[model samples]
Target: MYFWFLLIVKSVFHHITPVPKIALPTAQGFSFIALTDILYFKADNNEALVYYLKPYDTKTHSAVIFKRLSDIEAALHYNGFLRIRRNYLINTYNIKQVNNRAIVMANDETLYPSRDRGKVVEAYLKEHFYI
Candidate 1:
């Protein structure tokens, strides 16, 4: 009963809340990419790469966004993004598979969570994916 209640509440909350979108700078202008379309964010030296699926495109595409992983995680974490590792911020909805050591994104990219965050990851997976 408790599980079903929580599931229903989550479903309702997800539908009630609008999907978040972030503007990415382009050569012409800026493009707003929906958070749901993103697979993950991999941190580079001083910037991060956003990997996402384009509308009607089967292949995943990437763009370099000028932001720190921590900053991006703070902005999107509440909207279904998780900072599994120090350098990786992943969209929970785009998770293909998760294991004790690593998480596989829809694009077949493998990311490992930090040891300190292992329990948090497990709890999240259990609550969201029943893993």
Candidate 2:
């Protein structure tokens, strides 16, 4: 009976999808953020600024990570994150509005689409709407 119980517990745990997380260096030490907490990423000079949803409010808190935006973008590609512009990567699940030239996030932050990637952005918007 114990062997059967252990096997059942293991099987249940194995079928659960693990939460996605990223480790980022902070002033104190490091911060681990679940992907669901991420709101967007903005390109700084040589790093990426990560914006995360704050509890009990519509605002976001930010942290600077010493990683390239492209690198972060690739890491988050499979997690509903989309590179909407040359300098911005947004969480599609957090999008509140889509406009001709910009997207508004749940926190009311507006980010413009890349001029060079206009067609791609349009296609993405259409696909998202259709689903």
Candidate 3:
């Protein structure tokens, strides 16, 4: 019984540990983006544009990185980021409103959620609101 309790406690502690930060390369050097700060990732050809949330700013700042949106989506999915479209991976925490099939982000950007992913987004919103 003690061994089982110890194992469960260890598992909980492991899950609560902080995830590794993502390093984004820039012209100057690199920027470390925490999972909580990411607003969304937009695919632009072979590059992915990362938008980050900033306090006291109405708009989010963006940076282009040489990575695929799918790749970023996979890496950040466990951190509350969801791929709502083929070209968009958005942080669920930054969602402001849901208008029909579209989502309004905290930065006031309107993005269309994919038809197949609409239900998923709705469920997430419901869970977020504890409704």
The candidate scoring highest on lDDT is: 1
Q: Per-residue lDDT for 124 in model 2? A: 75
Q: What clash count goes with each model?
A: 0, 0, 0
lDDT of 1 by residue, 1-131 (tens): 99999999999998989767889998989988988899999999889999999878889888999999998998887888988888888899998887667888888888889998878888898898777
lDDT for each residue of candidate 2 in 22-121, tens digit (9 for 90 to 100): 8889788988987887889999978989999855766689999988999988888878888878888988888888776778988888888888876777
TM-score against truth, every candidate: 0.79, 0.78, 0.75
Q: Name the regions of candidate 3 deviating beyond 4 angstroms.
A: 1-20
- What local lDDT does model 1 show for residue 117? 83
Q: Whole-model lDDT, candidate 1? A: 0.88
For residue 16, model 3's alpha carbon misses the true position, in angstroms, by 15
Which ten residues in a row are the worst by lDDT in model 2?
122-131
Displacement of residue 42 (Cα, Å) in model 2 is: 0.7
What digit string (tens of lDDT, one per residue) describes model 3 on residues 1-131? 99999999999999999865678897789988777777889999999999987556666789898999988887777788888888889998788888878888888889998889888878977887663
Overall local distance difference test of candidate 2: 0.84
Better of 1 and 3 by TM-score: 1
Ranking the candidates on TM-score from highest down gives 1, 2, 3
Per-residue error for 102 in candidate 1, Å, reads 2.2
Off by over 4 Å in 1: 1-19
Q: How far off is residue 57 in model 2, in Å?
A: 3.3
